[model samples]
Target chain A: MACFLVPTTEAIVTTIATKIIEKKEKEAVSTELEQGVELSSLHRERFSVKLNRLNHLLWGGSLLLAFEHFWHGEIQPFFPFLTAAGNPADWAEALHEMSTVGVGMAVLVTCVWGVHTWVLDRIAQREGMAQHEEQARRAIRK
Target chain B: MTLLITILAAVVTSCIWYSSARARRLKTGVLCSMFWGASLMWLVDAVAEYIELGAAYFTPAAQDMLNDAFLGFSVIVLALTVWVVLLFVKDPDGVVRSALHNQRS
Candidate 1:
């Protein structure tokens, strides 16, 4: 019932990390610009972009799942928030579900995101290669 | 039932995202991931329940099925609401910004 909490926790951590990293990235960019160093893309996406994608996936999924849990009356607006908190037996079951279903979901989402980032990187690398080839061919013709 | 519904939503959103580059501006990928993640979570839940209940898992009560269907539909609505809010805030087309400017002028 409280399975969404796992991803919600992950999202919170990632959100904080994104904010910190984003600040650092902006500072780095400014320093590079001040040094008159030309920043090249190399067709590679920024780490922040990839992190944001993971953040989006985690946050959006957690939010929707939380809403669904609320709809099912598993969650309450009151203290404890979870219906399973009322009793020890139910609490134990909830914990079991959290460990199994919740953890599984969190891990699954992370794995999917990892694969997605890998694919994007591969695509970007291929694009960079093609651009390099095109430039080389143009230079030869010139 | 919720699993089925979410899987369908994920497939539909993914198809839209893949077919239309314009949809990327709307950030349909967020919706796609949300639905797909939910579907996967539900699938795991279903499997766990099957293990616990064995053959009885296949014969869920009618009321439970209805409840799941409602929950699935509600989840879809909530996801759409979130996506819409994001779109409005981002205003990728500058629609809101231009509207405000027009009004001021």
Candidate 2:
């Protein structure tokens, strides 16, 4: 009944991590600027941005699932929050579901995001290589 | 049955997202992830039910099946609503911005 909680937990962790990494990214960018690095050449997507994407996916899915659970009356706006948490037997079932379904969803979303990140990285690398080649050609012509 | 419906939606949305640039621009990937997550949850629930009920799991009451179908459709509708809101906020093509700019002028 509380399968959404797993991803919600993940979302919270990622959200905090995103904020921390974003601050670090800002500091790093400022330092690079102080070292005379061109901001235009700092075109790579920040890790925090990638983490934010995963956070978005997790939070969005968890929100919809939580809404669905509430719609089905599996969730309550009261103490314990989950209808299944009222009794020991049902609480055990809820835990089982959380361990299985909830964990499965969290893992699946992470795997998909991992693949998407890899693809994005590949695209960025190719574009960077192409830009370097173009600059080299212009230099030769000059 | 609900699991099947959600899985089907996830697969269809993923295919659309992969094949269409506009769908990607609109962030259909978000919808895909939602559907996929729900589908996996339901799949696990189904397996648990099957284990507990054996052959009876395959013979759910018609009313239960109907209710499950409605829940499945409702989940899809809710996901679409959320995705629409995201698109409006993002305004990928600057559609809302342009409309507002035109109105102001």
Per-residue lDDT of model 2, residues A64-96, tens digit only: 679779988999999989999899998998898
For residue B6, model 1's alpha carbon misses the true position, in angstroms, by 1.0
lDDT by residue (B1-99, candidate 2, tens digit) is 667888889999999999999999989988887787666556656776788899999998999899888987888888889889989999999999999
Location of the lowest summed lDDT over 10 successive residues in candidate 2 chain B: B37-46
The top-ranked prediction according to TM-score is: 1
Error of 2 at A128 (Å): 5.7
State the RMSD for candidate 2: 3.7
Cα error, residue A139 of model 2, in Å, equals 8.8
Off by over 4 Å in 1: B100-105
Off by over 4 Å in 2: A38-41, A78-80, A119-142, B47-59, B97-105
lDDT of 1 at A102: 91
| C-alpha RMSD between model 1 and the true structure | 2.1
